[model samples]
Target: MSKSKQELLGYQSHLIQDNLTYFKPTRTSTTVTFAEEIRSSLQEPKKSISPKFFYDENGSKLFDEICTLPEYYPYNSETEILQSIEKKLLPYLSNEFHLVELGSGSSVKTRLLIDVLFKSQKHLQYFPIDISEILDQSAKSLCMDYENLKVTGVVDTYEKGLDFIEHYDDKPNLITFLGSSFGNLDHNEGMKFLQRINTLMKSDDLFLIGLDLKKDHEVLHNAYNDSQKTTAKFNLNVLKRINEELGADFNLENFEHHAVYDEQKGRIEMYLRSLSEQSITIPKSDLSITLSKDELIHTENSHKFSISQIESYLKESNFEKLEMWFDSRKYFALVLGKKI
Candidate 1:
């Protein structure tokens, strides 16, 4: 049901053994890469590490917690859209196509789409790409529950998994990039990723993307910085990761997590700020870094989009918007796109 460490540059699978295929990159990065990234990110000007690092086992659990919090709206809003728009999205799917999911964590929301597809087609092939291996009986459970469904799990980055599917398989696909995961990337990086999807997929191939829509500043801020501090624990868990893996001296109690809504950038920025001046030594990277009082290490930027902005992204990424659905409150958007 759950596998940890599926974040970018995080998975280390060597091979896929069975029909429950996992995406193991042809080349593997050394363990030192983690330390290298930490060292580089903590350098002078901009102290930062990717939000992807927040998906390690513990971080993933914390995120699961954040998703269920009352203040968080994206999960519930996107689920509402998927529930309402399934029939509309179904007409585009072909009987022989593969339903590919990028960053398919838990595959919980995926059932809505698959249910609709099964009504028309007897059998279906699914490629649920994530950075984590299936921990529970996901493959067994899905196959048993859906008699005609077969799943191939990919434990790799989105790019690597998409490349594998494009090169090795020719099945027309209805790819779902749910969860607004793309928003974690900077605007340019997001476009580049979309551009890759445009290139690998055919003109008729379907693309579904879920994005958090720009809303009240307080709402966005509360979503990331909940009253219960679940998100705070989630953000600081990254430091716990470094302490455990890199032999780094990071006192969790000395740092506090906070989030801010960046109005101009249309993003929610999460950071871990040092409470006081302190030095941390990471033996793996052979690096020692000192923090000033209240110094912040930027952890993530979750960008929200307006409808107009979404249209611009769709056009620039070579996708034509086919159908768009939003929650009753218009807090989230799920758009079905056609590759142009």
Candidate 2:
């Protein structure tokens, strides 16, 4: 007799019950705080919005689509680099360490490292920290796929996750901040972020980081302004988030996505350019703003780095650079550092 589908998949309940634990802050950032951030950001003379705001459910879905576009080389290049670095990383991988990842969206690239670590160890512990509830599904899938793997997920900001990990002394950890999310912050902010991680890490604990490398201007430009307009959609979705969650009336059509590689700055700058003069109101904050024709609201900056800069950042943050790998085209990098 054939078994029912439920019976065939019944092990998932056990996996969730026994192998997975999720930690979320009792009070996550509220919509009121979000409204205040929006108000404060717009009030700036230059007019801007935090790129961190661009990950509401819809924005995240749009970004996932953008990643598949032909012009988005960072995601693809970083994945390729990870695929080729397993053997070289073996010296640092062992049964005695835990894997902790920051901004582990979908965890597609992490699976490669997991496979590498499993070669030397029978069981593994993984902690993926992110603000999205995708943590639940990622933990469930990982637990079911690897019988010996256990998962502890944290749904919170990077700082909060670091605070949590600082208390977890079960074993040395290989903490990872991947997918060039580090580039999202300006230099000072990035330095402070790395320092905080350094403080949370034990001596000689591993730190793996992925970064987008400095490349030709054309390549950088195309990567953010994809031909499919998916990148545009992702950028505009931030406006949609403010509209729905912050009670703002933003005519998405009146804003156009603008991305350009600023070679002098060694970064790609993304902005939402107002098509014409327009006044927008947000009821949540009782804020009103006017934008002149072609006025720009800076949305994001993705800073590309050279190897020396990466080494400098790691060293300044009290880490010793262990090794670095790159894709064939040198379009992205994976650097492994040890806490000093």
Candidate 3:
């Protein structure tokens, strides 16, 4: 970060409330309400659940497990960069800024930044935006862990979280979207998402985004399809959610978890395949669906990006790329961008 950008991020203003609160959803965070989404996705032409549905309480716990697994390298890769760059990044942030994180599941990786900021600054406000109530638990934990920080939990998606920040808060902000969750969207979707982010940012506001770097097909394939089968369990947990919430009779044993890398797409795809043709019913949604033995329901897509692609994305999003740091092997990237 340059001295000029630092001046931009060193935002100052008075808060009307000046306290922690939940921000209401201003837009469709869960595309088509939960019940409707399950029904819509299960409709014939394409049978799939948005990956966003994969983060229910149980699913979130499973994900935390998946991150620790040896086969999954994203967590470690991002953490490595944070640890290595923490010292270098301290001077760029303001003395008292709001640290907002999107999809801040567990927020284990965020501790690296938290440590750095606490040492250099007198006070910090932490706003962790997530779609789960788990953010409450995480926020509570962070409050206990840090003394100079005031932790606020924003139980909303990234889109609405930005609305809350733009409308309610006016402190210099450093927003973080970690865990390479940005890779969940495709190119066009990513561009639009970034544009929305750019729209909310102040001149000095900064965004630190984690991006998974493109690697070989085999390496990418194994990351999602771990030897421990934890990733598989994580994927199948989506059905587990439907069964629990929608009263759907989805036999866990009948659906197997599968993930593959699409070299052409530069992404890793995860699916739940039916073991045998079976009909299932979701009483809540008033929906019934039959699946062929080998039919697959796409659950998630993790898009990988090259450094050049990241630069283009930042430029198109109306953000000027400031700096990018990668892990030793360059398997992942943490990019710092300033709003233009």
Candidate 4:
């Protein structure tokens, strides 16, 4: 894997273990069957898939590629914003704080924040939770070089609850859910998620969230569609996953990837459109689904936000926005909120 600028800093030292236990997901055939059933049902009329399923080991890697594509503005825009504001953001962080990150994907962009924090604080503990085991291992190994950093990696989704973190001794924690991963949820669901985090925090704890700003439709569309075709492959990989896990017959070549910004919904919709009428069977679920020509199966949504809207959401979720930072173009934002 390619190391970002912050990753180089994390590797300069040696691995430090905080004696944190590794959490792994219990893989069962039922899980695969459930996924197939959900996919089949979503195709009937209104189509959708839980964006959570898009981060299997291969999906994680594909997404990393999508970030680097020239057409993908979200990754670069957010990275630029973080790198530019990290210096200022450090002053708001305390020296004794433990950094907990939600949906800590490969923890690539997070290295930018962690590196800056380690530089100023000297000795800070870290916890990164994600559902992808591959990403968890990748992040853990990368952080190994930071001798003073102790990592507690959890392989679970944020929606599943944070019971995994209960064993740890309580302290002033700085929790972050960066990369606008929260955008995967609808407005109501997103607020509920924030409320859940508010329950997890003490009065003095901090929450830093990254959000992609609303921008030109063309720019947003290109970010998801990508001229390099990486995003397309990433979108279609779901079917490949189905074939491998559930004994589904899905010809990857039979479908084309489509992503478009839905202005009314303020979200990017990803779908796999069938080039021709096709029938797919999932042996594990003992289910069959038929697709008409040009039919689409929705895959994911990336919702953009405005600063005012986010602040309102924070208030509703029992959090108060403390500070916010943005890039020169104002393409992205990193907002820090305190539990109220």
Best by lDDT: 2
Q: What lDDT tens digits, residue by residue, belong to model 4 across residues 100-206?
A: 78877446676777787886688776777766555356555655766776666665666442544533456677788878788888888888888988887777678
Tens digit of lDDT per residue, candidate 1, span 47-108? 99778778888888788888889999999898888778767776777777778888765456
Task: Give the per-residue lDDT digits (tens) of candidate 3, residues 1-340.
Answer: 2434323433232222334444434333445678898888889576999999988888888988998988788989999999899777877887767788887644667778888777767888777777665435666567677766776656666776676666555677888999878889988899999999999888778899999999877778888888999998899899999999999999999999988888888888889999999999999889999999999999999999988999999999999888899999889999998898
**What is the C-alpha lDDT profile of model 2 across 1-340, one tens digit per residue?**
1224223322111234688976665543554477888899998889999988898878878887877888888889988988887888887877788888888654678788788888878888888888766544556788889999988777767777766765655577888888878898888999998998888787857999989999888888888888888989999999999999988999999999999888888888999999999999998977999999999999999999998999899989998888988899999999999878
| TM-scores for every candidate against the unseen true structure | 0.91, 0.91, 0.90, 0.87
List the candidate 3 regions with Cα displacement exceeding 4 Å. 1-31
Misplaced by over 4 Å in model 2 are 1-16, 27-32, 133-136
Model 1 TM: 0.91
* Candidate 2 local distance difference test against the native: 0.82
For candidate 3, the TM-score is 0.90
Q: Could you tell which candidate, 2 or 4, scores higher by lDDT?
A: 2
The lDDT for every candidate, in the order shown, is: 0.81, 0.82, 0.81, 0.74
Which ten contiguous residues of candidate 3 have the minimum total lDDT? 9-18
Give each model's clash number: 3, 0, 1, 1
Q: What lDDT would candidate 4 get against the real structure?
A: 0.74
